[model samples]
Target: MANAYVLVINSGSSSLKFAVIDSQSGDAVLSGLGECFGMSNPTMNWKYAGTKYDVSITGGGDHHKLAIKRLVEIINEYGLAEQVTAVGHRIVHGGEKFTKTIRINEEILAEIIKLSDLAPLHNPAGAKGIEAAIEAFPTLPQFAVFDTAFHQTMPSKAFTCTISNELYKEHGIRRYGFHGTSHYFVSREAAKVIDKPIEESSFISVHLGNGASVCAIKDGQSVDTSMGFTPLAGLMMGTRCGDIDPGIIEFLMKKGWTQEQIFSELNKNSGFLGVSGLTSDARGILEAMEEGHKGATLAFQVFTYRVAKYIASYMVTLDSLDAIIFTGGIGENALPIRREILKYLKIFGYKENEAANADARFGARGIITEDGTPVAMVIPTNEEFVIAQQSAALL
Candidate 1:
């Protein structure tokens, strides 16, 4: 049997992150990024067959069309274009309309664009890329895998806001978690690691990265998650001020802050960067903390504290947590952060195996918990591969 290959594309407002993966084995055959679109120095690069290549776009990166054209050209040059069976796109927001991965059609594309109001920074670019891909490979099977789809299983208690019913009904206002793909993938892997059936598994999947979120998964479905309405609500992220009081926004506006200015502050200047008055990168914060920087220390404390608090709070949602699964940039690589967060979970009987916890980083995956204690494991999230697999499955 031939391996099924999927071209996975995650399109941002100004960038495209793409990979070709063998869904059967979950291995990316080729991967790279196309970024700085609409700029003078627009560029695209990829790593394929143990070789890396860089290409400067001939004209300005005015739009997704040019970058995608070059992408298809390269794929054809490599002869993998024909081998590719389908394409999977990562749509950041599907609103309440799309609850699962579905093959894309004209109606689907239209729906994707309509939901842009809910994900201004993501859905529009995703829709544009989908349009380009349709133009590029008109016959290929393409699918839309939404980040919010997996969380649609969340019960009303977990998804509802205390706002009026009219607002939710009329404006589509309510909690819609992001990173659903990550949470879903990690929870399934956590079940495997614990040697338990996914149907019986319960977990608090913590996807800690620049954009972080904690999700409570039970029986392989998302019961609740940290992110709400937008990606801005969640664990203290690199820049997002997660879970703030509504009054703060109005208060700031009355104090002479514009709506745009307040949003910029909350989404770009808060979190570790705002708290530490330093860079948003966790590595930088850790290094600064080691060097005795007070701001860094404070950032580390607040970051870890909030994460631990979230994990603890999520524990009540699950009848029995099979494990506290950690996966994402900061969750997988930042052992110090994981170790610190686990220390806070010690009260819940999560004992980290110092050696294993320290060893599990940079492509490593394993249980970081001590023997016979409540499990806390680190499993790297593979959202792209999940996208590839889900995209293939719909066929």
Candidate 2:
């Protein structure tokens, strides 16, 4: 048989990201992003063999379907479509029904759609992408790699909400942490760095990106995580408000704010953007802070402090802390954020290696801490690889 190639699709509310990976070698043969989807000017930007390509699509009604069609056309143009044996989709919320990766079918697609309410901003968009892929490649096998699957190992004490048990039983309201693939990948890599078996290793994997979260892994299993029930409950992210008081919602409602208004504020207008009254990107926030912007300074401090607090609190769950691995965009690239976080975590004997931390940026992976207990390290996450691996295994 020809070498199996898996195409991993991560569809968000406004964009679709894809990578075609060689399953055996775990390398991305091609990757791209379709941005401004569902808008007047839809654009597909891709990289192939270190070369860049950008094309604008005109009059594509549904960008999800159009993006997949264009992607398929590109694959066929390069004569690489024949090598693609399977497709893997990144589903944000799997609820309790799916605890592992599974083959996608009509029934499964329907279930994913049914779970849309749980992840209104993600599931609907993901379902649209899946449908489009299925239509475009009817013969190809596809699988769903869920973000919530990795945290299924969490105990009831860790996942259960403080609300009434009846409400949880009826509504399935509990902590279903996001960013499981990144946390799982980094934790395994961290074990290898320390020359310890993952089955016996304990780690706090911090995934700080536009959408951030922290995970505590004990013996390769998720014990507890920062995000609860939805991606909105985690560490402060680009636009989402993380860990806000419940009373605030009620207070806003009493002030004549509709549920839609409140939801929009929390999910799209809050977090670093809300606090700083500036752009949501961490880089922009940091730049503004350097310019003596008080709001930017406050936002940056809160973001780092919340992350540090979670890392410290997760220590209680680990009997033996092998290392704390930082992955994702902010975690791997932002040196000052890493330093500030470590400064607060001095109790764990973590001392940052200034030069090493400075060098670890833009996908560079290495230990950034001086040789000591609970070493600090940066490991750029490859979630697409994990999706491909899981999809190929299912096939």
Residue ranges of candidate 2 with Cα displaced over 4 Å = none
lDDT of 1 by residue, 285-322 (tens): 99999999999999999989999999999988988888
Note the residue pairs that clash in candidate 2: 175-229, 176-229
Instruction: Give each model a TM-score.
Output: 0.98, 0.97
| Cα lDDT over the full model 1 | 0.92
- Give lDDT per model, in order: 0.92, 0.92
Sequence-dependent TM-score of model 2: 0.97
Clashing pairs in 1: 38-61
Show model 1 residue runs off by greater than 4 Å: none
How does residue 201 of candidate 2 score in lDDT? 93
lDDT of 2 by residue, 235-302 (tens): 99999999999999999999999999998999899999999999899999989999999999999999
